[model samples]
Target: MTSVHDGEATALGMAMEQSAGTVMIRAYVAPEQMGDWTIRVTAIEAQVEHATPGLQSYQLATDVYAEQQQARTWTVTLAIPRVLVAGKAVQLFNVVVGELPRLGFLTRFRLDALALPEDFGPGPGFGAAGIRQRLHRPHGPLLCRAMRPAVGVGTDTMVRLNRDVLNAGYHLVKDDEVQVFADNRAFRQHVEAMVAARDEAQAHSGERKGYLANLICEADELAERWDIVKTLGVDGVPMSPVLQGFSTLSMWRASGKCRSLPTTPSATC
Candidate 1:
């Protein structure tokens, strides 16, 4: 018999067993297809065992249904037995949305939400507290500066802008997500110049500041850029995990090179 975790948060708490795996995903469905959706969603997610013995499989355990748009729209919240995905967020997404297209029961559907177990990855290496400490701004709103016209802006221009911002009392400055490994603006030179500007500004402003350099590059080149940032002693770096892949960010955090400096995840422009 399949274990059904019903109710709301209370049942979710009760379903948390060491051996029991579970995850919650919300999908929209047509009002008429709720019955078939309940049956197929559960079986496809959890019932089909993985070909590999140790690999985890999900079963649709329970669902919460709701009506919206004057009963014109229907949404279902599916409680699935948790399946662990170690390295690849892409694989995790595959598990969530891969089977839906094969089953043509729902009219229009979207994977809207995901709830993972508490014991996930290393979490954030430097969280808000750490970022505050690094920037030397313990309280009040944090000020941020961004490098505009990211493309074709050479290292000299970037360093000059950072210098102005640092002197103008901006606590944190970041490279635009569009700024990747470019010929005109190389990663190493940009970081080196930013570091130089930061030191020069600190001497005058007497306030500590940080730089979140952009590391949006090819998947294979992520590690190389991360190393450049660390080696050049850049204060921090901004990573576009959606574009560069979340696994890259995970590797950077686990690399232990960014332990002292903070790493921020940015969305692709």
Candidate 2:
């Protein structure tokens, strides 16, 4: 939890020490294009400079080629001004590897590492401890389930599934990422039905159970969907941040609506 002042001081100190903010990027240059890698690096530097204002300096590390290895790779490390990315997740990502893939010089580009001065992103609304507290499970595994048959099912079928799994001791259940509001049954009706089923199961079992509605919709509908979940007292939500964009998750976390409702990010890859 680095404070803003501390981050600022650290950034200033790094600049004075000629290091700046530490952000490392790694990419594999095509073997045939190795000779022109410097030009690519120059292009990258120019792009980074344009993208990151107030960036103090950057350096490209020595190229590494293993003996008898065909693949050649370069590591680029730089220190950016902390203010540029402080508390900004999307900006941080953009500054690091936004358009680097579009450079068309590297065979493969990867973000190897990142060092943030402060708690840069909208962190988890309810971390592990909070989740445990909410679920009333102080120890042991908190079992979770994803509703199957993501599509082609009515709200009644989904509700029955929720009730059955929750009654059988599952701590949490969520909608699959493929389940969208529009393609499936009415979003509000489906969510409300599932929530009701969850409540009934919890009351019968005398244990806390959670329901996470899939809230992956268009950008304009995100807030509205979130509001529906919150208002209906759905325990949490499952979202595909990569598909929806990381900023969507950041916005949700920052909106103050996620204080009690937990979010699970569905895997994209």
The weakest ten consecutive residues by lDDT in model 2 span: 37-46
Instruction: Report the lDDT of model 1 for residue 149.
Output: 73
Cα lDDT of model 1 by residue, 26-116, tens digit: 4644445443222122212222321222212242233432221111122344454334344345656654555443331222334557776
lDDT of 2 by residue, 1-269 (tens): 11112223322332333322233234643444433211111111112111222222122232531222222333444556556455676766766665444432233345667666545565555577888898999999999888898899888898899899999989998888788666323788888898999999999999999988887777778767777888898877766666788666666566675553224455211
TM-score of each: 0.65, 0.67
Best by lDDT: 2
After aligning candidate 1 to the native by TM-score, how far in Å is the CA of 56 from where it should be? 30
What are the Cα lDDT values of the candidates? 0.57, 0.62
Model 2 residue 16 CA deviation in Å: 18
